[model samples]
Structures are given as C-alpha cells and as structure tokens.
Target: MAGIVACVLLSLVTMVHSQVQTAFLEYMQSRMGSVEERIAQWHDHSSRYSSELRDFKNQVLKMLENIEKEREAMRNEVESTNVRVDRLEREVDYLETQNPAPPCVEIDEKLTELQIKKKKNEKYEKLTDCSDTVSQVNAMKILKRFGSSAGLWTKDPIGNSERIYVFDGAANDTFFVFPRMKEFTLSTSTRKAARIKLPFPWIGTGHIVYGGYLYYVRQTEEFQVIKFNLANKTVDDSAVLPIEDQVPVYGLSKHNYIDIVADEEGLWVIYATRENEKNICLAKLDSKNLGIEQMWDTPCPIENAESAFVVCGTLYVVYNTKLPSRSRIQCIFDVSGTISSENVPVVYFPKRYGSHSSMKYNPKDRQIYAWDDGYQIIYKLSMKPKDELH
Candidate 1:
C-alpha cells in the first residue's frame, strides 16, 4: 500500500513542472513579436525623416543658386554704370580742354548783359538772382580808434555832406559829429568833434544817420525803431519791431539788438522773428511816417553774425568770431530776387583791429563804413555781376 502512494505523488509533481515550462515559453514568444513590430515602425519613421531632409536640402541648394545669379546680375549692372560714369568723366575732361575759359573782362561784360538789376525805384519786377555780387574787399583803411572797443561811425549815405557821426558805445546819449572825413581822420582828439546829445539814450549799435535823421533803438523799449532828427536832437517817430523772439539780432554780438539799415530802397531793419528763431527778418519802412511798408522773411541767419548791411534791397549778413578773426559775408537775402547766397562769392574782410561793431553800406560812395574795436574803417568793395564771380 506505501509504494502505490509514493508513485502517485511523483506523477503529480512531474505534471505541475511541465505546465509551468509551457507557460514560460508562450510568454517569451508574445514579447518577441511585439518588440519586432516596434522595431519595424521605428525603421519606417526614420526613412520618412531622411526623405524629408533630402527635400529640404535640395530646396536650400536651389535658393542659394538663385541668390548667386542675382548677385552676378547686380555686379554686372554696377560695372556697366561705372563704365558709363568713366566715359562721361572723360568726355567732360576733353570738352574742358578744347574750350578754355574766357578772360574775366569778357566774362564780366557778358554777365552784365545777361544780368537784370533791380532799379532802386522799381517796387515790383521779375529778375534773376545774379545782378551784382561782392567779389573782393579791396582796401581796408582804419581811420582812428575812439572811445570803447565797440562803437559806430558813418557819413550820411545820401547827401554830399562829408560829416561823419560817431556813437561811442552800445548805449549812449551823446554822439560826436565831425565836420568832414579829412578832419575826423587827422584828429586824434574828440575835442575837435561837435558833441550832439540825443533826447533819449540809444541802445545797441544798429544806429545810423540818414537823410538828416538818426535811426536807432531806444533804451526805454523792448525793441523800438526811433527816428530822431540829427539837427533838432528830437524824436521824429517810433515803431515797435515785430521780433518773434526776444534776442540779439546777431548771435555773436552783445548789443546788436536790432539792425536799422538803409539800402537803395530806403530805410530797413534786420532782426530775428521766426518761431524757430532761425533766419533774419527784414522790414521796409516809410521814412515819412515810420510805418512798415513791406516785410520779408529773409533766409539770412543770425548765427555768428556781428552785423549786416543792405545794398539795393539785398541783405548781406556779416559773420565773425567772438575772438575777432576775419569777417565774411556768409549769407545774402535779396527781396527783389536779384541776389542769392549762391550767386555771391565768399566775401572776406581784411583783418583789422577787431570784429566790426557796425557796418554801413553807402550807395553813393559805393563803400562800407565800419567801426571795428573803436577803430573807424572804410572797406572798399569790388562789385560785379554774379556770373563773373567764381
């Protein structure tokens, strides 16, 4: 009975071991198949990515080739333009060599014929901006040094009166009147000059005696043009200037508040009146009533400018350094359109005592009376048609 029981137990153990081995083999086979499927999917994805990369590379190569072609075309165009420019330059050089420039005398004659000047009396007329331009400052004669470094001295622009009036400073009540130019030039003392007193003290260096009347800026106003009789020493008329901003007329000057000048067209004034405070403002005044007849916003700026003078309705702003170097006419604004900055040549004043305090242009003598650092000066000018200027 014991042998039979042992045999049954062994058979049961063998059956259990066989079943476990078959289950392990089935699990291994399932796992291997799933892994193989995953590997196949990965391979397919890599192949698609590779194909897309190749397509992108080809597109990039095509774009680069097109860029190179455009670059070559641009290079060719630039080369063609350079060649044409070279040819034009050569042609210009050849033409210049063939026809040399004419003499200055002949050129002046031709320019005089071509240029149309504005008549002093003509109020309105169409004309070119090339009538007459200042070429050279021929002679600079320093008359004498009087009073302070800043003053004004000038003869009456109109009449044949050789009398010269001298204002000794930017602010003053009295001025000296000389009998004649010769007497003033020879005398070193102020005793010889007749002292004339103004009813009101004047301010700034923009004062001038014209037509027996002294035009100046009065001390009691922000900026007023005062017409005083030189003979009677009384105020004839007064007008407020239309200054947009409150500043000096010349930026470099300390007392050139507003400039009252006289040209061929009569009384005028120069000031800065723009909102931007840029260019100078010119106004024409009626000598009788001292009313504004016309106004022109000129293009001449007040920068580094010490003074200005008008000739035949043309405004010439004179520029100089505060340290006192050479003075030059940097801007020209003509109301009649007969003179422009481009039309005029670079006009430089000869070096003298110092910067000019006041410069007055006389149409009668065709000269400039200037006061430079207390020294009275006469600048002889060379005028010519614009075409004759270089």
Candidate 2:
C-alpha cells in the first residue's frame, strides 16, 4: 500500500512540472514578438528620417545655388555701377575744365569764426606766457626688458626726488620705483626698482606721479581715482567722478578708461562717455581728495585719440591711425579760454616703435615722458612766445 502511494505522488509532480514548462515557452514567444515589433517600428522611423534628411540636403543645395546666382548678379551690378560712376566722374571733369568755375564748397561759418577768433586771441593763447609745443621727441633711452610692448614710466613732477615709477601694462598691482632716472634707464635687474605693491589694484597705464603721491585709476567699474602715498605706501584718498566706462577714453587704448595727469594746472582726469563717445570729457581733479572741481565738454573727438595730457589746464589730445604710425596732437581744449586750439598748430611726435601707451607731462621738467611700445622716451617742448608767432 505504501509503494502504490509513492508512485502516485511522483506522477502528480511530473504533470505539474510539464505545465510550468509550457507556460514559460508561451511567455518567451510573446516577449520575442514584442521585441520584433519594436525593431520593425524603429526601421520604419529610420527610413522616414533618412528620406527627410535627403530632402533637406537637396533643399539646402538649391538655396545655395540661388544665393550664388544672386551674388553673381550683385557683383555684375556693382561692376556696371562702377563703370557708370567712372563715366560720370570723367564727364564732370570735362565740364569743370570747360566751364573753369570756382570750386563750390559749403564753408562752415563756425569754423571761419573760430579762425578769426584764433587770430585775434593768439597772444592770450598760452599756459604761462605761452604754452610750449612739442617741438621734438627724443627716444633718448630704452628701459630694461619688459614682457609687454606697452608700459609707462614717470618721474615726480613736484618734488626734488629723483625717483622714477614704472608700469609694464594697463592693469597691474606692483609698480617698480627706481632710485634715480639713470638707474631706471640703465639697470636690467628688477632689484634696482623697489617693487611697491598697492592695496587696491590699478587699471590702465594712465597713472601719474606728483608731489610724492602716486595717482592712479582704481581697478573698478567706476574707475575711481586713488592717491597712493609713496612716503607710507598707504591709501591716502579716493574719489569717483561722473564718468562712464561704456567706452574707453581712447579707441586704440581699450583698457585705459580714465587717464590721470598732472601739469602746471594741477591734477586732471580725461575720459569718454557712452552718451558722447565721439568727444572727450575733461574734469579738474582736486589732488588732495581726487574730487571733481570743474568739467568741460571738449570739441576734441575721442575717435582716433590714442593718448593725451594736460598742460596749464589745456588738454593736448594725441591722435593716431589704426595702422601704427607717427602720433600727433590733433586737438586742444583750454579750460581758461585763453588758448586757441587753431593757432597752436598740429604737433607731431617723431616716428618711434609704435603708439603711446602712457604720456605724462612733467611740469617740473616741462617735458612729456611717454611709453612708446616698450621703450621709454621724452619729448622736449619749445615754448615759443605768442609775440614771436606774429
């Protein structure tokens, strides 16, 4: 009886196992079908996309062909226009030759008035008895090897100290101060200059040294002026004037937003504004607090100005070309209304390595110390009396 029960249980277990196997086979087939269906859908989408890609490519090629045709038509039209213009110019020349009429030019009354005024006020147009003109520029000496091509080197225009300050680029924190001008021009070692670090970083090579104080534009959006006391290496004072940084003061010098300069008239700041990008704005800066005492909207356009400096409250803006060549003082603005810009004549700097990065007019020396390329140079001015120009 026990043996018969064991055979029945074994038969029941085998039947259960066969049923499980059959169910698993059906599940696997369903899974395979699902996978096959997804594969087919993917193939169909890929084919459609490929066809669309081919159509897009064909359309692009057609558009390109149309563009080429239009370009060719425009080129031909331009050539025809040029020919017509040449013919018109030749006809005009012939007509002018036959008629021999005086050249008709709309003269500017304002300019004529200015010329008249300049002639009348020629004697009064002076800083002292007469403002000196840059008669000659001498690249007397080149400084030690600097990594950059643009830099600044200036001596104190107020004190009797023979110390010289140097800057390598527009943006820097450390400026080297040499004991004397001779040591600065001749020495190659960095040890010769006492590296003075600033609490606030300086922007642009447009820094000036005067009365034992180093005045520089603080590296900020406002381009605030900072007076760094050389005697103590401490921040003496700072002032922010109404100046825009949207456009640099000079087009060529994109980094020099504000230029601080000192002359016989004391401290001054030169800058450009977004509202008036074409013209330069001048402000008299109080050296004690770097405060704005007076402001002037100059007629001197800032478009081609590369550098500028103040002398006897008169701003001498130096202009340069896109291609580096001889820089010239093309514009002048006198705050006192005593000097006439037209009468002064255009002053040019002698051909050098390149454009000026920094130009500081030393009132004590009555010379302009400029950084041309990487070389330091000085411009000697010939102060001609107004009576002599007559």
Candidate 3:
C-alpha cells in the first residue's frame, strides 16, 4: 500500500511540470510575434520620416536661393540709380557749352562801339559781327584804336579812355602796367617791347581787368578776391577772403567764385555757395571788414553771373535758364528781382550765339561791354546817373 501511494505522487508531480513547460512556451511565442510586428512598424515609420525630412530640406534650399537672387537684383538696381545721378550733376557744371546757342544779352545803341584799326591810323567803328543776322541800326560810330600793337584785353569800370585795353599776350606772368606809349625804340642794340607781367598765370577763364595797379577777377574758380600788385608783380598770397564769420563747404573749398570788380570805394566779388539743393548764395563782398556784408539767396542756380556787373549800385546777375524742353535762355538780372519776364531781358543773337567771357560797365558812356570770345560787343542799358550811387 505505501509503494502505490509514492508512485501516484511522482506521476502527479511530472504532469504538473509538463503543463507548466507548455504554458511557458506559448507565452514566449506570443511575445516574439508582438516584438516582430512592432519592429516592422518602427522601420516603416522611420522611412516615411526620412523622406519627409529630405523634402523639407529641399524646399528650404529653394527658398534660400530665391532670397539670394532677390538680394542681388536690388543691389544692381541701386547701383544703376547712383550712376544716373552722378551723370546729371556733371551736366550742371558752369563751363559746359552748347554747340549752337542763344545770345548772351540784348545789343542796343550807345553800347555797340568797336575800336577798330582800319588803316595805319586809329578808327572807331560800330562793333558788329557782320555775320550777325539780327537787325541793328547804325548808332554813332567812333574809331579809338591806337596804332599800338594789341596787348592784354580786360574790362574795367571806367567806360571812357579805351573801351578795351590791349597788351602783348607774351607778357610775363608778373603784374606790370603798360606804359602809356605806342612805339618805343630803345636803340636796335637794346630792344625792350612794351609788355607787362601778370602776377600769376592768367587763369584761362573769367573777366580780368587792370586798374589802380591791381588785377581783378570777374569770375574764376580761385578765391573771389585776389590782387596782383603791379609794383611787385606778385599774387597777394595774403589771399584776402570776403567771408569772415562764415563756414566753408569743406576745410579745403573756398567761397569765392564767378566774378569780382573793384572801384575807388571798395572791391565787389560775386560768389556762389550752395546751401541746399534749391538754395544758392550770391554773396557780394563789401570789402569793409574783409567779409561779406550783403548776401542774397536765389532759387535758381546761376549758370554764370561772373559776366554781370553793378550799375549805379544795382546788381545785375547774368545767367542761363534751361527750359523744360532743354532750350537755354541767356538772360540778365535787373534791380527788380533775380528773374522777371519784364525786367529780365534775353540776350539777343542773330544766327546763333557762343561762349562768354568777362564784362565791364562804363558809367561814363552808360553802356555795358561783354569781352566775348569773338570780340567786344556793346549793349544799351537804362541806368541811373553814377553820382546818385551811394
């Protein structure tokens, strides 16, 4: 009976062990299948994520390329605009000349005197370019040319004596006056021509005049106020400036420009200084304290007022006005205002006109002479008596 009972226990234990082993195998299989399914799903998700990331990167690269192209295009446009502005400013220079231009000023009686040497003797003739097509009536004619050879030609305040002074062009650049003599023969052994030296290389532009042993500049890029003493023949390097209590455009730039004139009372220098785009200063040197006492600003940029002069204390500004169509009008400023259709008269030309030069006012003759490139041409003007000028 004891042996049978032991056998039953052993069998029961074995059966129990088998059942536990089978259950453990089924659990292991189920866990392995779930792991495989999860692994497949993770691989598919990773592939899809990688493809999407690549597409996003490509879109970002395209956007960056577009931004770079836009930046380059803007840079090119800005560069082009700057180039155009520079060109327009260059055309505003005063020295620029047109091919076939208009007249500078109106020519009238009293001012058309041309000192010509017809024969060996001096003869006064009406100054007119026979080539001129404009209508001109014969005013009184006079011959003032002396048999003396031509010398330096400059405009002066005094209208009498010689409307134009002539000196040898070969005169050295030392300020010396021509002795009031026509012919001189200092023996054939020692031949000295009648010549004077200017202080400096007579700067090639503007009206240059000689009087009171001083050389004057009607217009130039140099300082507006300069003097060449005939006694010493040296540039008054002292470089007297008309503006005392004023600032300059830069440390190097000066205020003097265009024209200058001198009389017994003092010297007058007309200069241009730009303040803004629209405002331009036309300062008049008073010469009292070596500074500008009176200054006037104009809206229009004066083309060239150096050819202008004061008559009876009234200032006349000569300038060229460019119309909308680019046609130019050479006009003069009067006492009325800077520009007025009634007061501002257009310079009269026949077939055409050309460049300009220095000008002078003859208070005695009541006329204005422009030292033009062609020759001296006269214009009639209505002005008050000189004595009335304060």
Candidate 4:
C-alpha cells in the first residue's frame, strides 16, 4: 500500500512540471511575435517622416531661388530708370544752350502775286445753287465774264442757296448779284447786273453790311474806308467816313489793317496804326454821324491781324506774330470779352503760310477751310478736343 502511494505522488509531480513548461514556451513565443511587429511599425513610420522632410526642403529651396530672381529684376529696372533720367536732363540742357529765335516775315512779292492770281482763278466760278433757272443761268453768264466775281464765299455751309453779293475792284464803282430763280421768267433785277461806284479802286479788305450800306476798304495809302448803299445799289458820297477819322495818325508808317463790321448796335471799325510800332484800336461808330462812340486798345503787339466776319456779337481776330524773327505762331483772339476777364488769345499752329481771306470758317459744320498759298492746296481742319490744347 505504501509503495502504491509513492508511485501516485511521483506521477502528480511530473504532470505539474509538464504543464508549467508548456505555458512558459507559449508566453515566450507570443512576446517574440509582439517585438517583431513593433520593429516593423517603427521602420514604416521612420521612412514616411524622412520622405516628407526631403519634400519640404525642396519646396524651401525653390522659393529662395524665385526671390533671388525677383531681386535681380528690380535692380535692372532701377538702373534703366536712372539712365533715362540722365539722358532727358542732357537734352534739356542742350536746348537751353541753343535758345533759338523766331522767324521773320518773308514777303516775296512775286510769290504773293502768283498766289493771289491762282486763288482768284480758283474761287471766281459763279457757283449759283438756286432752284430757279432764269436767274441762276443769267447770273452764271455774267459771273463767267467777270472771270472771278469774288462772291459766293464758301466760308458758309456747302448746301446753302443765297443770292451772293459780288464786288469788282478794277471797276471799284460796281457790284453784282446772282439771284436764285423763283419763277421761269427771271426777275428784271436778275437779268441786269447791279452797279455801284466807290470812292477808290480796291475793295481788298473784307466788306460788311452796315446801316443799309456795304462798308469796305480801298487799296491806297489814304482814305481807305468806302461805303455803298444796299437799298439803292449806288455809291453815296455823303455817306463816306468822316474826313477827320480818315486822316492817318501822325508818324504812322503804313495802314496795317482796316476792318469794318455792322451789327445790331451800329458800325464798328477795327484798324491797326503803324505809329512807330503796330497798335490795334477798336472804334464803335455811329453809322450816320461817322463818329466814334467807344474805343479800346488791344494788349498784344499784333504783327499782322486778319479780320473774320463777326458772329453772335463776337469779333474774332486771327493774327500771326513775328517774334524777334524764326518760328511763326498764329493767334486767335476773342475780342468780345465773354470768355475771360480780358481778351483771350488762343494759339493755333506754326508756319501759317496762308492768306487771311483764304482762311474760311464754316460755323455750321464746325470746319475750318484754309487755302494754302505755299502748297497751293485747300485743307479742311480737323476738330480737336478742348483737353488737347496744351
């Protein structure tokens, strides 16, 4: 019985040892698998972080390169600006050193005569744009004989049909009219040309309608102002300008310019006297009395001023200056005193080689037509914006 107890106890001890060994072996195998999994996770995380760091470094390097390029471009722009500044300064200094003078008037008489003849021939045609044939046809025949009637001023709009007033300087005593046809039979007046007598020969100055008379200048050193009665179509000697006013000023070298115009107020005369130097004077005279009512002296020493017809009570003087004697500057003055505190002058252009009579303004179209004596061509001026004046 004791021997049987010993064998059973030994078997129990062996079974316990075998169970402990199996449990230890299972625990060691599980720990080894966990350690290997941890190493693999650490390696994967390290590779991801290294790749991200390399991408960030490349982005930073590209940004730095772009900044350097921008800095270099700015430096080049600054250098170019400095060079332009230096070049402009040098050019200004050179211009100041030269200090050029204005050009003198080159009055070539032969050229002037040729230009006058050409203009006369070109404008002489009787462009009678009338609806009636009797008057228009008869008038054109008379105008053609005159060669250049000096009427039908194109300064007016192109399509206007008005009976044009004609004047003859060679026969300074006569004027003619081209009437528009209203009936098949011509008006007795239309068939026969109108005739009038002048105190002198040459109606060179622009004429104006005033006090039922036509006032114009004669081409002579003395007594230039003459008048023709429009109602009678005859010259009235008693209606001539006053003898006292006609007398030239003392020390006056030449008759610079004489312009007459009649408005709602009365007759107005503007003439420049060459009393040592040119001085412009305005005289508002009574059409009948031939007496001056108001006079004002222009501020500018006009070299030569041309008189354009008055419009809307404003008198405009187109003048050119001969400054010290190289560049020709043309000036237009509004003598009406409506635009400014004083008479305002507007500069037009340089080298105006044209005639005063040749310059025509059609206010309806806002176009300026000029007959260029130098180029022998007619030019139409383009409209300019006010801001472009400077």
Query: In model 2, which regions exceed 4 Å deviation?
Result: 1-147, 386-390
Please give the TM-score that candidate 4 achieves against the real structure.
Answer: 0.39
How do all models score by TM-score? 0.64, 0.64, 0.40, 0.39
lDDT of 3 by residue, 72-141 (tens): 9999999999998888777755335544466697765344223111121122122221111111212322
Local accuracy by lDDT, each model: 0.79, 0.79, 0.42, 0.45
Sorted by TM-score (best first), the order is: 1, 2, 3, 4
Which pairs of residues have clashing backbones in candidate 2? none
lDDT by residue (1-390, candidate 2, tens digit) is 999999999999999999999999999999999999999999999999999999999999999999999999999999999999999999999999898988799989899656543432132222354344443454344455454777888889786899888888877788898899778767877778899889988888888888889888886556688888999988888877655444789988888888889887688888888877888888777788776666677889878789999876678899999898889888888776755667677887888788888888888888888888787877877665433433
- Backbone-clash count (model 2): 0
TM-score of 3: 0.40
Which of candidates 3 and 4 reaches a greater lDDT?
4
Candidate 3, position 390, lDDT: 24
Cα deviation at 371, candidate 4, in Å, is 7.8
Count of backbone collisions in candidate 4: 8
Better of 1 and 4 by TM-score: 1
